[model samples]
Target: MAGSQGEGWRPARPAGWRRRMARLPLLMYRAGLGPLFGNRLLVLHHTGRVSGLDRTVVLEVVALDREVPAWTLASGFGPTADWYRNLKESPRTTIQVGSHRVPVTAHFLSAEEGGRIMARYAPRHPRVARRLCAFMGFEVDGSEDSFRRAGERIPFVRLVRSPAPGPAAG
Candidate 1:
């Protein structure tokens, strides 16, 4: 509801119940309920920047490239989100999509790329795109240009799967 009124709206970091609710997906994933969400959502396992402890966050998969084995995600809460920052410090991490855990390397996409991705995503998931843009303080008119502009303002990252380690030499 933060951006319901549109421009100049910036959502505050979630706290208390909201924070707990946001984290519920992580618990579900750990409980082996990940398949329920399918490939739409993924659990990102990362290291805390300051604490050096393991951390996990569930994020929606905005795009998926089976060929590259990559998943693109947007920072709904903006770049200040802990998970986003953590990836910056340590790009090497893992993600769980359904029952599969994949080793991946985070690659931040440029604004232009984000715009194109958003433009493509909007038509595929119109309602979600609208709501997501609104939640992120962007006013999208359902036009490709509007969605592209909104996407430009959002930070996106692509997690490309790392190749399996080769067998060790005897």
Candidate 2:
């Protein structure tokens, strides 16, 4: 009953122990333990839209085109997520994945584009795609079409890196 449309599948913000536990990986990354899985995950640093303070979050890379030094990420918590909003307020930011750290800009992708990305992604990483779908409240039947549908409902962003570290957009 996860991906039935409406608000049945919306992700709620984590709190208490859940919030603290979810931050463990970010802590590890700060402690120099990021390289272990940096190829697949990244630590994003954005300025809070309201607080004007720096914030960080770990996001799984949905797609990575190293040729362009760009990475795609999905907002499982929807477009209103804190980090997503933060990035919108300041598109210029930094991300660290493994040993690769770069200044990047966040570009929001249309749902159709997201669907296409997911379609291509599912074939390459079926297990991860399935898990992602489930986590996003998408109850897919393990089919590419279903996965694509789920992607259409999720907001996606493309992080494009600059040639050099740039000044903050804020």
Candidate 3:
């Protein structure tokens, strides 16, 4: 599951925690368990916020926001999630699907966009979404304030496939 990394995007861990987790199987479980259990997990490679080292996180590919061409990570522990913060700091990132690794740039959605995405998610996974919303302190109201209170704490980003690097000249 290890692979080459490049610039952009932020790692979703908090310093010491990331290092400690690396030595345990929990990191693997958090990064791979869902994918291993019949889910499409997109592996994201991001740089550490402090160390500037690379860190990989596995997140489920829930839905593609057609209007923005961005993938929605809604209600996945709300908007305050770590990965969201990483993307907020640096949108450029790498997404690894199976053996295919592609470079992409991320855009953190505004309150309006995030609200719409959250609405779509609620219908699909009401129970989980509610749990996430509650934990993140968000109401079902589709307003910027609600999103700010709930999502600002979590991390969310919309990614676009980045152009491939040109062939190197000899």
Better of 1 and 2 by lDDT: 1
How far off is model 2, as Cα RMSD?
Answer: 2.5
Error of 1 at 134 (Å): 0.9
Model 1 lDDT tens row, 1-170: 22454444457778999999988998898899999999999988888889988887899999999998899999987888898998899888888899988888889999999999999999999999998887787877789998998899889999999875111100
Candidate 3: Cα lDDT at 117: 61
lDDT of each: 0.86, 0.84, 0.54
Error of 3 at 169 (Å): 21
- Model 1 is weakest, by summed lDDT over 10 consecutive residues, at 161-170
Between prediction 1 and prediction 3, the one with superior lDDT is 1
Q: If both were scored by TM-score, which would come out higher, candidate 2 or candidate 3?
A: 2
Poorly placed runs, candidate 3 (over 4 Å): 1-40, 65-69, 75-81, 139-155, 165-170
Q: List the candidate 2 regions with Cα displacement exceeding 4 Å.
A: 1-9, 164-170
Per-residue CA lDDT of candidate 2, range 1-170, in tens? 35555664466778999999889889889888999885788898888888888778999898999899899998878888898988888888888888667899999999899999989988999998888788777888878888889889888999999765634432
**Which should have the higher TM-score, number 1 or number 3?**
1
Error of model 1, residue 48, in angstroms: 0.9
- TM-score for candidate 1: 0.88
Off by over 4 Å in 1: 1-10, 164-170
